[model samples]
Target: MDDPKNARRSDSLDLAYNAALTKLDVATCEAMAVSQAIDVENSELHLGFSVQIFKKLCSHSVALICAVPRSRWVKSEFENWDFACAAGQSRAIIEGFLLFLYLSQTPSCNAEWTAKLLVLYVNDCTRRAKMMANVKAVDAAEDWMRQAEELKDRLKLNPWFLNLDGKTQKRCLAGDHLMISSRDEILELAGWEKAEFYAIWDLLSQYAHVLPMSFTRMEPDGRGSGAANEADADYLTATIAWCADTLHAATNRMTAGFPSTETVRQGLDSKFEPGPKENRP
Candidate 1:
């Protein structure tokens, strides 16, 4: 016999999961519409560059959504609910959402946007240089480091970058973040409560980084193998909830530059809200 509480939880999970998938489906279609509506030639050069990055992120997001679930057993199982795998992918989606939101916003001026782009380029080059150096590719590492220096110099020349404090300039040069806003501020801008978001993010990070929570929480079934059970279901539910909310948020931001997307964005506000205050019954 099953516990009534457990059964109710399962039913709720089903409803939530279905709702999430529906939201993602709608978001995906609307995102494509926004992509199609982008008039690059007529748009500001900064917007053109930003939209290209936004389009690529959306493409990757579509792939992540499709890859989230799959059948693993022919006999009885209909899906693989590996909690670690699911959490890892969900973290990727969350991180991608941060970048997507950053790029989707319109800057005060082209110089401001250019400064942001330069920060990103410097970060990329720095990471590449480090990666090459780790593998003993001296010449490649030196080339990448040189490029990073050049980008940093150009960033310094930007009026917007020049206005930044010394600490922030150093942080940008070190490839820490592209925006002047702190990470917490960015999350708050996206409608997440600071502590609540970190709680969920930390839980996902444990699984993503393969901490003790990964194996310590597993249980053995009578068949001498671990099985997807309640906990896996919980992780999957969280993933779907977060991803669905992220997709909707990204689409909303897309509407800022692509005005045509506003029509589709309508009626979507009531769909998926991750923040505590905005959650609907």
Candidate 2:
């Protein structure tokens, strides 16, 4: 009776361990599927379409969290949880997406992208200001203003803004009171100290003039811009390369750290023939 009871308990434990492994396998598959889908959809976007795709990618990240197993095993297993990896991956994807969106053709999207970019710039400025304050630099204010001027220039040249010519550019800077006023508003809301505000302003001004022309110079029609097509293809290729490299590194790490399960070891050995052994004296 006691022996039978022990066997039943061992069998139950085995079943539970198998079920946990199956769950992890399923979650990994789901994560791979989502990653592949994002890679495919990323190729379909023109400049302005990235925002939408980024949002979709983030949503998928949330879904990925539910598929991971709940048990605590090793540190690596915790790190490999679908939610943790997805969150980090989503941030990288969003940043790349925004970089592409910054190259869009429409004025409205350009303005929106510019605004978003300013938020990041101002945040950086805030950090710099705190640092300058700590060090008490005498020339901090002057340096900040120069940075702001540079930013202003760059903002004007950003691809979405349609690269205004020399006369128009000067005229817009001088006559566009709304742009000036909006900059003030943004500065106030961003809560940067004086030096930081100058830094952000200069940086944005400089960013305004660098036109983002596509290398491919594709004809503009409903079929999509050639530059965008080429860009998408290049991005997809890079993403696949990254994924492959990551997969290889992960496999190597796992192999080095842990012995393979019996089934996996057998499968691997099945591919090779054993040679006759030589005896040494």
Residues 1-281, model 2: lDDT tens digits? 46997677656644553454444333323323322223223332232243344334334333332322332222233322212222244234333333323322233554655733543354355446556767887478447545645655665666544454556445333322223124444434433255754553343233233223222233453112322123223322233233223332222322332223112322112111111011000
Task: Quantify how close model 2 is to the true structure by its C-alpha RMSD in Å.
Answer: 22.5
Worst 10 residues of 1 by lDDT: 272-281
List ranges where model 2 is wrong by over 4 Å.
1-69, 72-107, 132-145, 152-281
lDDT of each: 0.68, 0.36
The runs of at least 3 residues in candidate 1 whose Cα sits more than 4 Å from the true structure, single-residue gaps closed, are 69-77, 221-228, 261-281
- Residues 1-281 of candidate 1 have per-residue lDDT tens digits of 99999889879876766676566656655565566656777876656766775666556555545544431101234445566655766777787777766765678987888888899898889899999999999999999999999998898899988898999888998876666667787887788888988888888898789788777756665111235466676666667677767866766666776676566443333222221122222
Q: Residue 11, candidate 1: how far off, in angstroms?
A: 2.4
170 Cα displacement, candidate 2 (Å): 21
Please give the distance, in angstroms, between residue 100's alpha carbon in candidate 1 and its true position after superposition.
2.2
User: For each candidate, C-alpha RMSD in Å?
Assistant: 6.8, 22.5
